[model samples]
Target: MSISVVLLGEQESMVRQIESYQGELIVTRVCSEIAEAVAACLTAGAEVLLIADAQQVPLMEQVDELLSQGTAVVYLLDGSAAISPMPEVLQLPADIAMSDLEQRITATVRSLKLPEGSPERDDRETADLEPRDKGRIVSFWSAPGSPGRSTVALNFAVEAAAAGRSVVLLDADTYAASISIQLGLMDESASVAQICRIMDSGSADISRLNAACSLVQVGDTTIRVGTGIPRSSRWPEVRPSALRRATLAFKDHYDLVVLDVAPHIALDEQLSFDTQAPQRNAVTVEMLGCSDDIFMVVQSDSVGIPRALRAIDELEESHADLQPKIIFNRVSVSRSGRSPKRRLIEAWDRFGPMHDVVGFLPNDSAVCSASVLAGSPLLEIAPRSSLRMEIRSLAGIKSSNLPKKRVSRRFSKSA
Candidate 1:
């Protein structure tokens, strides 16, 4: 299939440069009015929209509206141009020059292309033949330096399982393979390595995968855990396609699939064996791209607040559509020397208004100590802890907010 695109700008030279591309190109010239340009692009069936430097600020809103319409956009910026303070509002990848713009447009188009006999389409065709009762996927992620992502993910999975939901906790963080070590399940007998090997050979059956999974029962909840690779470099072997397929298979067998992805952006590699992959500073974007909702967890401190603000900007740049729910972990009323609510408000005021303060987890030494000793979730080890209650309340809010009819319909269709 040929690539279809629409170029929006007043610069005739830039439009001509895009017209020079090798593949099938359809270019529409839009002058000053941003709305008309966007409407023209949409009417032309342009899958990718390229905005040149000549476009005005109002053009950004049109870009946003196009994105909402499912059109991938690439912004062309001058190499020497001074970046605006609010660059996050322009939620498209910025290209420094004509070549960069060309590359991004091509990449976006290539990624969106449907492969021959696409798996998703094929799966939908056999929807009646396969089990459809596959449950929801709740993924957990946090900023780099230990915002308690794993702990929260593990406990949330445990709590959901305890609520009579069949949950499978997947340790998708390839950089640090700590879930096994944390749960004392790191043994030669069962690991994700074997599963990866099976998948690498293109012979990973459901039975083989089930055989590799280690089941850990806590109280009334049964959890199947998937371990990560020992080293971060091995992540390339664990392709996102494979991870997605594995999750789909798990969804068929479980009621909920809780994923713990690494606190990094997903990147592509030409060779499957690259040791040091190119890291895109857009991790938040990558996570939001794949997630239904995002829970941004931050420690209530000076350093944490600053980092959260930076992370929010990066996330907004990648996914302006995602409104992340802010979770204040380790919030201490006395530590702030004033009201905790007041401090939180101050932080929000300084950072941005795109975040919502959903809940706060109190700093509790007992909960931390119990988690380390028991190698279990805080909810299991310290059920009465204030931290546990806060986490439970957050989980309850998520559960209550979920549409009952939608869940039932999804499950019924799967069944």
Candidate 2:
């Protein structure tokens, strides 16, 4: 058998993956509380004490005590680059595939010398981790420039939270990361980069994920907000596997996983004859891959409309699996001369390839500016404004028409 695991804190998804995997790992005890986790070591005979949250970083001493007793410590961290106080111990990403994470954790522990008087050790065959459910991931993206992707994502998240569902608004945009600025958050602390680090760290659980997510109020709705890359240049740090796991983990923690993704699909390393190298724009595509529903944000002006339609056509061709709902933002009814919706639909049906348009959002610069200035959602700044009404209408449509994932029972026993 592999190492016995004494899991602590909340991350049912991670726990389920570990236990369900066909490995030598036997989970002797799984504790929901941190105290239980620290104390479980003494009686459970577990060789590995796995803490799911980086937020419990203060528990280093207790972890060390376990280590001194020969219990291997594996902390799943949120993407923060904070070095572990004990370097010899294993640190794994929370959102990593259970099979991959298990192999790494077990192999690493095997390589480490068993401490004096320690006994929790097994030398059996091992493998990696996979994934499971949490909730439906809704990702919003746009073409080259700003199509209010973040704004729309923020609105949807706030509206969903206001409707009594837990919502997480994540800014994974590789281009001009702007959620911190849009929401007026001065603390540039938790970004996707940090979360990626945690997922890569192999110890990330709900607590560490939440530690990386800042709670912000949008209107009366309070929701979790995951910041984006501090700078566009830091895009290389985000990996597709890490992002998938992080999103899956976030789904477990929240009712809705709303991600604002990057704009392009460009590779980061193409020359490495390996051909499997990471790409910078994988941020957008991978999010699309995981998304249950995708909203392709687009402007409604003449130039913007044609560009967006072409982009949508291209997306349909490139990502056949993704049925992205094209959202035409900023349409001026009067300027269009005739019925804007009718004209657009007619044009879309004839010229566009996919021709699937969600609907049109009215253009209102005054209201948009007001919301930005107040650092509030459109509902708070100008609830009756056309833009807010359209977005709110879309939110209602989502609640009514979209299928939401029911929470999985797999984590109940372990969580």
Candidate 3:
């Protein structure tokens, strides 16, 4: 069977050359723009899309969309322009001889036809690659108000690292990039933004990605930190696709990847006049969707509980498979009366989602304040604090990093 193909914005001369060529590839449509070409490809069930460089440059930002639609995306590069090849997209010289073009296209199509994870496909891609394990991605998400998301994420990563696991904490909160400030890294350059930009250029690798992060030694263990945008206005630079790509790449290097994402998870961008417009909350949504595990940090207060429950409903509707493990922050008797933990558990059992609460982080204002002021982890200041112990438990550190309980000796009775 002839391989169906669509041509977008090709010169008439090139079109004539292709038309006169003898190959199994058959052109189904010629489009002036990418949108029309994509629609034509989808409607006609075209197996391949060949976009010329002149047309591809203007819509380069939308290239991710083109490569993602289950059709083979190829960029015909003319002498007038140069383009990089992504892992999935093919880049061929526009002035290639028909025979060579036919050979390359046939080979690419055959490869694309192979089933994912088949021995043939795996050998072709990974023959030279060594075996490696993918890291677990955990995202700390919360409602609009400050619910200790960053605090938990930072500590969780540190505790995991303290347990001898390789970890990287990514501050993905585009709205409020506070991890950098909290960690006291005064660098003006944003590490996460730089990493995303590198991914967008199709040049991201383990080495390049590691160079973009801040490697800090927490206790005896070291954990990498990918700081967020220096300014909130720069959120657009961290495109959703690029961030996703970067996070996936992180899996190859770290054992545990922690994401501290923004509170907003709404996908209201579709309501805009321009459907292709950049989404404000897309970063958060993408992180949540990509996370292997999501920890919903709900503040222990009147306003926070209601907001969290409502947010739960929204998340369920949007992300159908998402069942976040709830972690109530600031569990205090001041707010929930005596037996705060029991009350919070009962309330969640009554009104919250089906999953039981994962853990509760106790409110310790003095330790929190001191750690923030000192630009250090809470465990560093108060090693035996209840809050630190709880976080350690949440991180699955069975052996306590906290000091052994002190036993008091009284001289009273004999004396």
Candidate 4:
């Protein structure tokens, strides 16, 4: 009996090579869209998929539905593609028997289903639900134009770590990459893009995770850090497939995973069957989708409050499950706007139901600047800073008083 396979990822040379290897076996359809690949698998009963783009591996769940009917999938992992294999990963030559490849893929999919104690199952791509032990992912997502999202994210990771939670901080801000410079991590190449690259190849493990993450020590507490894209234009590197896998792997290891994300939420909708890359905003949306908690940081001013409100409205429209806690940052100390917090609350109340003010941080530029210059968090560099204390209180907030999450305005407020 011959096995059926579908080819994707637009790597025509690789696809042709695969076709040659299969000989008389069935090639159901050469598809570009993953959805089409799924349709091909179901309609034609393709037993395997030769995926060229490791970035497309997030389609695993959709593909897994096909697996129950004996379909197995694996990324071809050719070195010629955007993802380069590690020196240790030996490549399968073109002459390898098609039967040998089928056996390998069958084992890979089977291993993905067994318990973690099984050596073969360990570090494999298990997409949907991990055990209850999987950690929480908290993201600091704000509107663009420097609203202190990174600062809040870094501080939150530090606080979480200090509270004895194993934490990993991911700088995922694709637009204005700053986590590396802010932490004085001089190694430009040790960013999260490397992790994305490895995961894209469908082979991410503890060894790779350790290589991608940097450790920062605050007294006895340690926070693992994954730097963001060093350049904004290089958006293609952190594709959704890579992003989803890396986050799932980290969640498996740490008690808390923190992401400092970009602000935009646009999805690239184009007229091409091979448009696998979601918009640049796709990365941020992916992070939000995976995160267990979100802190929507906003500046406490007329311009900032209105902008933040608009952002929430937009996010709510697109994502129905967005119950983000609104954190008002840089509360004024000059007493110019008497009862600014009160006024901010009153303004939001009129718009619609709102999440209570999570907490407030003072405008302490000197302290934050000093900590950044020293390549340390305020907890270590300026423990006495008013900003640090406020953040501490913010982190220690009881969940019951977390302010009831309510629906936003019936309609969006004008920009």
Give the top-scoring candidate (TM-score).
3
Residue-wise C-alpha lDDT for candidate 1, range 1-415, written one tens digit per residue: 5556666667777566657754454564554566666777667667776666533444433544455455666556665544331211232334445565555555555544544246753443354354446577676766666777777777778778767788777777766657766665645333455555555444436676766677776654467777666665555455443455466566667777777766555344435545534332232234344454567777777777777777777556655676667887777876554788678877677765666788777878667866766676664566666676677677772433221221100000010
Q: For each predicted model, how many residue pairs clash, with residues at least 3 apart or on different chains?
A: 2, 25, 0, 0
Query: What is the lDDT of every predicted structure here?
Result: 0.60, 0.70, 0.79, 0.69
lDDT of 3 by residue, 175-226 (tens): 8888877777777688888888787766756787888888876666678889
- Stretches of candidate 2 off by over 4 Å are 1-133, 272-277, 397-415
Could you tell me how far off, in angstroms, the CA of residue 378 lies in candidate 4 after the best superposition?
0.4
Task: Kindly state the number of residue pairs that clash in model 4.
Answer: 0
State in Å the error of residue 342, model 4: 1.8
What lDDT score goes with residue 54 in model 3? 53
1-415: candidate 4 lDDT, tens digit per residue: 5556687677677656557866544566787778887777877867676675655553433543564465666556545545433211223433455677656555554564575345555445432234567888998988766778898889888877877888888888878878767777766674577887777555657577767777776655677788887866676677754676688778878888899899888674443437343467878988888788898898877677778877888898888677788888888745217776776677668873467668777888888888788777766777666787778787773323221222111111111
Off by over 4 Å in 3: 1-3, 7-25, 29-47, 50-60, 68-70, 74-131, 273-275, 401-415
- For residue 31, give model 1's deviation from the true position in Å: 48
Q: Rank the candidates by TM-score, best first.
A: 3, 4, 2, 1
- Worst window of 10 by summed lDDT in candidate 3: 406-415
Alpha-carbon shift of residue 327 in model 4 (angstroms): 0.1
Pairing residues by index, what is the TM-score of model 2? 0.63
